[model samples]
Target: MYRLLIADDEQLEREAIKFIIEESFPGSFTICEAANGLEVVEIALAFKPDLLFLDIKMPGINGLQAAAQINRVLPECRIIIVTAFHYFNYAKEALSLGVVDYITKPAPPEAVVETVKRLIVELESASFKERLAAEREQQLQQITGYFEDDLLVLIAYGEIEAKEIEDYFAILNLQAQTFFAAVATILYPNTPGASILEIEKRVLNKNVVGWVKEYMQKVGRQAYIRSIGAEVFILLLAEENLDEYQARLTGMRLFTELKEALWKEQQIALNIGIGGLCNETGQIGQAFSQAKYALRYEAAPDSIISYGDIERDQQQVFYPYHREKRLYQSILQGDIHASQQLLEDLLTWLREHTSCLEAFQQKVYVGAPRQLTLQIIDCAGSKQMVGPAVDAFAAQNPNIKIDYIIGTSPELPSKIKAQQMAGNVETNVVLTGYDAMGSGLVQQIWERIMPEQKKSFPNLEDNYLPAAKAAFDLFDGYGIVFAWCPGGPMFTYNPDRVKNVPRTTDELLAWCKANPGKFMYPRP
Candidate 1:
């Protein structure tokens, strides 16, 4: 339902318009009346009408002045000019004030009814568009959160391409030119008399992490916080042109405040370990390791430890960043011998330098041997266009191979599912339409192929159109449609046969009605 205000100096004119509206659009609007433009402005402010009809000639404020004032207050309200005179200047002024319709006094009832109905249609359309835009924004936010979480996991435990990280930063609008990792551990002593269940402990730790994340955001800090263990949360503090000493101080101050807040709110003791600064995002794993090593030196509760304080030469020969990178590269090249040699060297260095060789060996092993061949299944009809680009990408990256598979929408998902169930996932990526995969197929494929919680694609939105990115929303974060070529509903006509072709659906319908059997379109 909508509200409408009709204003005219002549009482008879107002009644005629009101009667026409009541008879034409019953129950559609609740009507209000005003005798002059001043009364129109006053009633409009109090009533907040959806539609307003105003007469031009008035005693005090004119219709144009009242419209300007009403528009300032309620910009969404639709206005109509109801005047006795059909003056060009009045019509122009009404147009400038964004009046939707101009009806002369003693307007035909049909014209008045049609004008009101048209405005209603426009309002409904605008409302629908707003709803769609809001839903799209919400979906994009969810996808963005997933992307950020995936990137953080890769930076902490796995390796990712530098270009891919840059693309992610672009999509997320993060200015993380430099970063350092920190590990926050909750100190909860298990008493001999009181035992806490494992699940309860996990929940408590999660709450603490959430509280810290909220605090960081409230204080306008550029940080990414993720829970990597039962009671351990990893924070990647990022900034532009980061100063090492200043970053360390900032980390210390942040942890201090968090410790105080947690103690006061939940009586929780927290210890934070700060790592060395890393200029490259790829080296975040190294920073994480340093932070973990620093955490070992936190002697007291609610303590803060920096790796630089304990270790004078922070650049140890056994540092896994460079060695692990090399090992990954070697594995990607299918060089078993070089990868084995590097692993052996790293294990030997760990045994000589660290007392906890087993733990360090596990970390090295997790980081070293993950080289995958991505199988891309393109179900869309753009394979012929994108095939050469795929080949060029493969040529550039000699270490990785891409197997581009072209298949129909019906065949690809089932084939991939079969391969997955058989314990062999030949298809690692899929390029298809939004509805290519059947319901629940994406979840099944994701569980089988990426069980380790790896991302299907890094920064998927940065490489595709927003509409195309939205198509992958149904994938449930399992896959992304990186490329799309829209194909449907093409119209063709010969200029000699048809002049002034219709461009819109309504126009086409009208043309068809006028031409009878002469105009034809495909049923589909």
Candidate 2:
């Protein structure tokens, strides 16, 4: 039910309007009455009525003045003007104030009923739109959290393009020119029971994570914190040209405060390790490694350790750059045998020169023959537009291959799934309409792929159109949408039979209503 307010200095006028509403529409409104403009303003503010009716002439303040005040307080309320005279100037002024209806005193029951019905429809539509907007905002916030977590995980262990990072920074409003990684380990009793472990995890996740996030926000810093292990949490501090010494000092101070709080509140102890700052995000893996190494030191309980303090003098390792280049070129030229022979010779040389087996293994793994193949399944029927560019990419990356397949939209999903079930490699990349992704096919395939592979794709926002990128995100990082072309409904009419053909759906609906038997559409 909706709230309604009736305001008039004349008792009979107010009673008449109330009777008309109650009789015309039963149980549709909860009505309130006011004698003058001042009472109208007060009642409207308190009741927050959906619809208001006010007489143009009142004792203290006029209907127009009351309406202005009500509008300022509750702009969503719909207002109607009731007057004894049908003055043109009064109607104009009421219209300027956005009054929904202007009815002269002694309005018929039918006029009042029709006006109320129209306003009800308008109010319902506005309320629905407001709810839909709020829901979309909430969904966007959830998506943002998932995106931030995925980006940080990829940065710490995998390779990502610089352009993708820049795009993410723009979208997230982060001024991340430099960053430093830190790891926090919670110290618990040795061989603790399952219940103890569970309780500690819950406490750390609820209290520590929330406190750190809130503190960073209060200090105007952007930090991404995630639990990377059972008892460890990793934090990436982002800033614009951060001072190295000051950053280390800040990290130590934050860890000290956190340790004190944990002991005082929950009787828990924490040890933190801070890594040296790096300017590029691609080097995050190195920073994480350094932090882990620093954490290996024997430090006092609830203390902070910096990687620089426990330095190591290590022997330098040599890389066969020229040999690796030739090997890659050979593979690009499709000379598999020659590439294999070069790789074997390089491994032998490393084994003979390097005394450390770990060093040799690292070199061999880094220089191994790498290949990536992307299968393009086009459901949008725009293969010709994007095929050549994909071929060019294959040519440039020589080690990578691109295969294109064209199919109708309906058959694409099942075909991909059938191939996966048959132990055959299906399309790793997809170029389909937004409808296909929205239909849940993309999500099905996403469940099968590894998490790391999903994070390997570049930022979708920087690469695709806004609408297309959003469609790809339906999979939440499962698939990459490299191309899209919008398609919509098309209408045709005979010019000879139809005059002034409608150009929009609304106009077409109105036209069809006027000439019902003259319009027809083909069955799908």
- lDDT tens per residue, model 1, 1-524: 99999999987677668877887888999999999878999999999998888887777898899998998888778888886444332433455465666786466677789999987886788484465446446656765665666666655553555667777778788876677678877777668899888787788888887887787788877677766554364555556566778777766677777778878988888778877777886656667777777876667767888776676754333355546777976875579999999899778777677855666578767664456587887776667877888889888877677877676664455566545333345776666654445422532444322222347445555776766756656555555455555764467888898897988766866675565445543321
Summing lDDT over every window of 10 consecutive residues in candidate 2, give the lowest-scoring window.
Answer: 442-451
Once fitted onto the true fold, the runs of candidate 2 whose alpha carbons sit more than 4 angstroms away are 1-125, 128-132, 159-161, 189-203, 236-240, 298-301, 314-524
Clashing pairs in 2: none
- Candidate with maximal TM-score: 1
After superposition of all CA atoms, the RMSD between model 2 and the true structure is 19.8
- Tell me which residue pairs clash in candidate 1: none
Instruction: Please provide, for model 2 over 355-388, each residue's C-alpha lDDT reduced to its tens digit, 9 standing for 90 to 100.
Output: 7668667777778568877778777777788878
